[model samples]
Target: MKKEPIIIGIESSCDDTGVSIIKNRNILSNIILHQEIHKKYGGVVPELASRLHDVNITKAVNKAIFSAKIRRHEIDAVAFTLGPGLIGPLLVGASFAKSFSIGLGVPLLTVNHVQAHILSHFIQDANLNKDYCPKFPFLGLIVSGGHTQIIKVNDFFKMKILGSTLDDSVGEAFDKIARMLGFYYPGGPMIEYFSQNGNNKKFTFSKPTVSGLDFSFSGFKSDVLQFIKNESRKDSFFIKKNLSDICASIQKIISEILLDKVKKAILKTGIFRIALSGGVSANHEIRRAFMALSKGNKKYEVFILKKKYTTDNGAMIAIVGSLKYKRNLFDSVHVSPYSKFKTF
Candidate 1:
């Protein structure tokens, strides 16, 4: 028997309010409304983000459903992001999902925002999704703007966090570094683009050694700051002429540091299958590094998510939710959103 295929996914976990429709493996419509309103602030303003999500969630969802040429009642299941995000934003999305599910008389599935990322591979990677997929009990590195974690995924619902950042996550550092280099607010991509022509050997950046497989990026961030300050003492245009090289060098160092720790975690956990998900994982340098780490190593088959799926989105949550629904896993309508709901 074929499963009832329509699932509506709502993502308001952060500044981006996304809605997507997934009928099994194919994506029918995915609409993302990203707020660049916080550009001047240099970081996401929680209140502003929540407000934007509230305003955009319905519009995005309507667009998704309409573009897919489907009615609300056609949606068999409703899926939503539950935690590890701004409470106001998550609540806006979560409550809407629950209410909509009730009105449509469909089952409700609650998806962990992080796990949605891994499940993203199930949608983005055709080889993994339709053909050769990883078996149970894998390792996943979940890196994003706000969170960084190395998790041991024993199953779909059960996993353990082996390591995480004590301070800033990798993507946050990228944005900060971009700002220090005098780029736009969301300077990560600009930094990566400029980094192409620069010399990584021009500067020496130190890697932070966290206890065990856990990580720390705060010290490395300070090192970058002090390095920039010291270089400015020699020349006013120190960052101007050397900006590309500085960005390149810093990006390379950061990528290497991440891969190194991930390798260590792989060995310690003895997990053969490893997957990466998050905004930072979209970085080409980091992706290349992860690919290099997985090559010819039969003990580990590394999973890489498509760049489009790496950032926060609704399809991932919907996919996770659909799978859980098939297993009779559902969340109550009485659930409320959480700001700091930590679970591995």
Candidate 2:
């Protein structure tokens, strides 16, 4: 029997350094080392992130290989996130991946970070969701700290951006709003937790009027800031008294804006199958909203990656690597990490 090729995936796109190994679409092992120091600053510090990645990459990769119980010779190729992230972080992972590939005399694959998030759904699952998979010609919502986009995925490599944010991403809005509420860095989960018991209609924020499927959240964020400022001046303890309500209202408006665009994309593409990816997809309210929307319409089918793969992770990178490797898509040795890149 021919042995399936084993591939190594490395990710250092932001604050986490991740490594994973996969064969035949099955994830053998996946590991992620998060930079916790950034929490003190309420957001990722690029230099700190890159420094931590440098410290963690080697150990992360070694652990992944050991957990996979694979010898160095078993890895057929190496894949790494190459763009659309902090240049320093990208370089850390890209450099490591290139060195590993050369040392192993294996092929190299450079993955687009955002595209990897969309492909994450294809990662092998050994649990109850093992058989779950979405067909082609679907809408993909990419929501993370750095990006918010609606993509029409016609095939593995054929994709079209239906819409994109003109300013802040959904995750950014969550974090920024959470900051306004005096929450720590990475406030998405905190906001979601508080929103559960609050009235979502307690506050109203104007949505952007961008034509077509494009989005604009900068104005929404500014409105939120202004609202909080005005309310605080009226009542010194306004935020303390209405934290839950504020969270609920903010989450509700963001969810509506995102789904509204998805609705538009559906009409434009005539596709009923939609998938949600990126870190923000982990938000309970957003997940619920997407699922509810799909259930309300018999024609809609929504796909969301497992919580583990929802964030920046190497499993997504590995899955994309495996797919590209099958088609002999390999990167040259001289390929460099890019700070900015676009996916079709």
Candidate 3:
């Protein structure tokens, strides 16, 4: 077998500062250093994220390279997140990657942060042959706090977003609902934990009305707010007592909404392979519902990224960059960070 090139990935698009070293499909080392400052703000503060990235990037890169047991000169290319993130943070990561690439005289591949999330599936379950991960022209669903969309992966570096959220992404919905229920700042997990004992049927919310394979979570979020307001009039502690059931129901509705879009994409495209990524994909109900649907079809294969890889991290960035760099895919150093979504 031919030896694969070593690709170093740097991710500072968000709160976590990540560094990963990938050699072909194999990950030698992935180091992530998180910032706890955002916990007080109930979410990521852009300015703080940028500052921390500047501080952590150096430590993360050194640690990752050291852990991988590879010399800096041995690295074949440098990979970094380019856009769809906080500008300052993205710049920090991008600048570092560009400088490193230039210094090493190796190629630098700038990766789309969201696309990297989907590609995360490629690195997480490396044990699985590429076949199980899905081939080109498959459907991909990316659901996170900041994004939600279904894209067609025509090829590794070629893609087209088929559908996206009109308002809030699924992850954002989860966070909003969690907060309204008196959950903490980052309450997605709390909602999930409390949802275990709740009855999904107790509360019925409207599913988003999206015609063209897209998604809309703002309406559902509105419904959640109305439901809480109406219930609170009856008893201030109603949610506290019925938190589990409410969470279960809310989670179920959101999962179904997302699955509906994926179903539409698959039916329209005639592609059976599907992948689920992003922070919200970590939800157990979403994973189970998606798995059940995929299992029913002989032509369908499903892949859900691991919890660690689902969140913003350099591993996904590194993996995507490695694949793209090997194919001679390099973005201009002038590529700037984009605050909104971008289609491939």
Candidate 4:
């Protein structure tokens, strides 16, 4: 039998430090260490995130290797998220990955953060529903704290941005709106949880009209703020009394806005295969809406990542790494990290 190649993936692109080990198409272990220091600040502190990555990268890698029961020498290649993130955090992971790969005498793979999120759909896991694996030439919807885009994915590395936010990503909008509603930091989950019990129709917010597939959440975010401010003046307890409903309404509007563009993209591309990725994909409301869009439609198929890979993680990076490895794509040791890099 041919030996399966082992790959190590490291991701410290932002607030979380992650390490994962994958052998062939199967993941052996994935370890993530989230930075809690930024919670008190209501968002990620770049410098603090970098410091935490420095502290945890080694530990995270060790834990992943230990959990996988694999020797460091067994890894054939090292992959790390290369760009489109905070420079500090990116440098931390990039520096560590380059040094480690050189020390191991293995080739290094650089992964684009956004591309990894979309490619994460291909990561094989025994626990995931096979129906969630999307085929090639699909429509990819990436929603996260830092990015929101509708992409046409033709192949492993061939992705074209059909539409992207002009300002304020979907996850950022969710967090900011949740903050206005008296929620704590990292409010996406809180908003999602509370939205379940609330009536989505109880409150209605204006949606922005953007031409084509491109999105503009800044205007919508402003509308949300203004609506809450005006309503709170009429009744000081308005937010408290309608917290659930407000959350539901917010989620409903956001989902609609996102899906509207997706609907347009589908119309434009004539591709029925749809895939959802990134942190915001964890929103149950959005996921349900996407699933509903595909249900009973013989021409439509929808795929979503497992909740674990929705956020910043090493597994996604490793999956991309494995794909690149097959193509003999490797990065030079002199490569550097960047806060912003195009996915294409």
Candidate 5:
């Protein structure tokens, strides 16, 4: 029998530095180091994020190898995220991956950040049942701070974008609203936590109108901002008193907007298999909504990634790398990092 190739994936797309080692479809080790310094700034500072990635990348790689119980020389390929992220951070990971590939005499793999997120479902683990994995030709809804896209995944590397955001991403809207509500930098989780105690119907926000499967969250964000400003003027403590309700209302509308488009995509394409990916996929409301949708209808089969894989992580990158390696797809050392989104 042929031995499975071992791949090391490096992800420094944004505030997190993630490193992972995988053999075949199983993850041996996945290490993620988050930059907490951005909390005070209310958002990721690109320069600081890059500098920190430079400082943390080596340590993360070493730790991942150690945790995976593998020697550096045993790696068959080095994979790293190449784009759709902050340029500085992407460069940090890409440069290291190139150097690592050369040092180990192995092939280098460049993975698209968004593709990794969607492929994360393929990552195998002892606790995950193989039956839960989605088959080919599934709809992938990627919701991250930087991107909002609905992709049709026909194969491991074959994907086509069906729709995308015209303005701000859903994750960005969550973060901005969370900051306005006095939450920390990554406000999605906080909003979820608080919304649990409030009623989603207590307040209402206008949803954006967009044609086809496309999404537009900028108008929704503006509606929230204007409502807050108008209400706060009337009652100085309005936000303080209705924080939970406000969170619930916004969360509901955001989740509805996403699901609405997803339903449209399903109806248009006649595909019932749906998978959620990217950072915003971690939103509790979003996950729950997808779960409810699947339960309410037998035709829809929903696959929600584990929370750990939902955000930017090396495990997702490594899984994509493993798939690409099987097909002999490798990148040259001269490959450069890009900041714009690309479909695989």
Candidate 6:
């Protein structure tokens, strides 16, 4: 029997420095070093993020190797996220990957950040039930800090974007709204936590009138801003007093917007298999809505990644590396990292 190839994936697309070692589809070790320095700023600073990645990349790689219990020489390939992220961070990861692969005499692979998020479902781990993995030709909803899109996945490499956000992505809307409510950076989780104690219907926001499967969160965000401003003028303590209710209302609307587009994608494509990916996929409300949609109608089969994999991580990148390795797809040493979104 042929031995499975061991691959190392490096992800420094943004604030997190993630490194992972995988044997085929099975993850052996996944390490993510998050940069908390951006919290004070309420958003990621590109320069700071890149500098931190430079500082953390080597340590992250070493830790991953130690945790995986593998020698550096045993790695068959090195993969790194190459696009749709901060250029500085992307360069940091890409340069490290190239150097690492050269040192190990292994092939180098470049992964699209968005593609890794979607393919994360294929990572075989204890947390993921093998039977729940989506087959080919599934509809993929990728909602992250930088991107939001509905894609038609025909195969591992063949994906077509059916619709995407016209303005702000859902994740951005959540963070901005959270800021308005005086939450810390990465406000999605914080909002979800507070929403549990509040009523989702306490307040109503106007949903965007986007046509087709496309999404528009900018208008929704503006509505929330204006409402908060108006209410706060009347009573300075309005936001402080109704924080939970506000969070719940905003969470519900965002989740509904996402689900509405997903439902449209399903109906238009006639595909019942739905898969969710990216950072926002970890939101409790979004997951709950998707699960409810699936359970309410038996015709829909929903696949969601474990919470750990839902965020930006190297395991997702490693899984894509393993797939590309099998087809002898490798990157040239002179390959450059891109900041704009590009299809794989």
- In model 2, the number of clashes is 1
Candidate lDDT (C-alpha), each: 0.82, 0.90, 0.85, 0.90, 0.91, 0.91
Question: lDDT score, residue 246, model 1?
Answer: 93
Clashes of each: 0, 1, 3, 0, 0, 0
TM-score of each: 0.95, 0.97, 0.95, 0.98, 0.97, 0.98
lDDT of 2: 0.90
- Per-residue lDDT of candidate 3, residues 22-80 (tens digit): 88677899899999888788888989898999999999999999999999999999888
Candidates 3 and 5 compared by TM-score, better number: 5
Task: List, residue by residue over 1-344, the lDDT tens digit for candidate 1.
Answer: 98667888888888999898888767788788999998889878889998888788889988999998998878898999888788888988987898899989888888778888877767734232234555678888888888788888888778888888888888888888788888877878888889888887888889887778778888999999999999899898999989888988898898888888888887797777888888888887887777777675756688877677888987787778777877888889987777774674
Residue 338, candidate 6: how far off, in angstroms? 0.3
lDDT of 4 by residue, 1-344 (tens): 97878899999999999999987767899999988888899999999998999999999999999999989999999999998999999999999999999999999999999999999888886214454367789999999999999999999999999999988899999998889988888999999988889999998888998899988888888898999999999999999899999999889999999888998898898999988999999899998888888786868888877899899999989988998998999999898887875758
Badly placed stretches (over 4 Å) of model 1 are 124-131, 296-299
lDDT (tens digit, per residue) of candidate 5 on 1-344: 98899999999999999999999889999999999999998899999999999999999999999999999989999999998899999999998999889999999999999999889988874212235689889999999999999999999888999999999999898998888888998898899989999899999999898999899988999899999999999999999999999999999999999999999999999999998988898888898899999889988889987788888899999999999999999889998999988656
Write model 2 residue lDDT over 1-344, tens digit each, in one string: 97788999999999999999999899999999988999998899999999999999999999999999989998999999988899999998988999999999999998999899998888876211336778898898999998899999989899988888888888888898789889998899999989989999999999989999998988999899999999999999999899899999999899999999999888888999888999998887788888898779878988877789999999989999999999999999788877775654
lDDT of candidate 6 over 43-93, digit per residue (tens): 999999999999999999999999999999889999999888999999999
| Candidate 5 ranges with C-alpha deviation above 4 Å | 125-130
lDDT of 1 at 126: 28
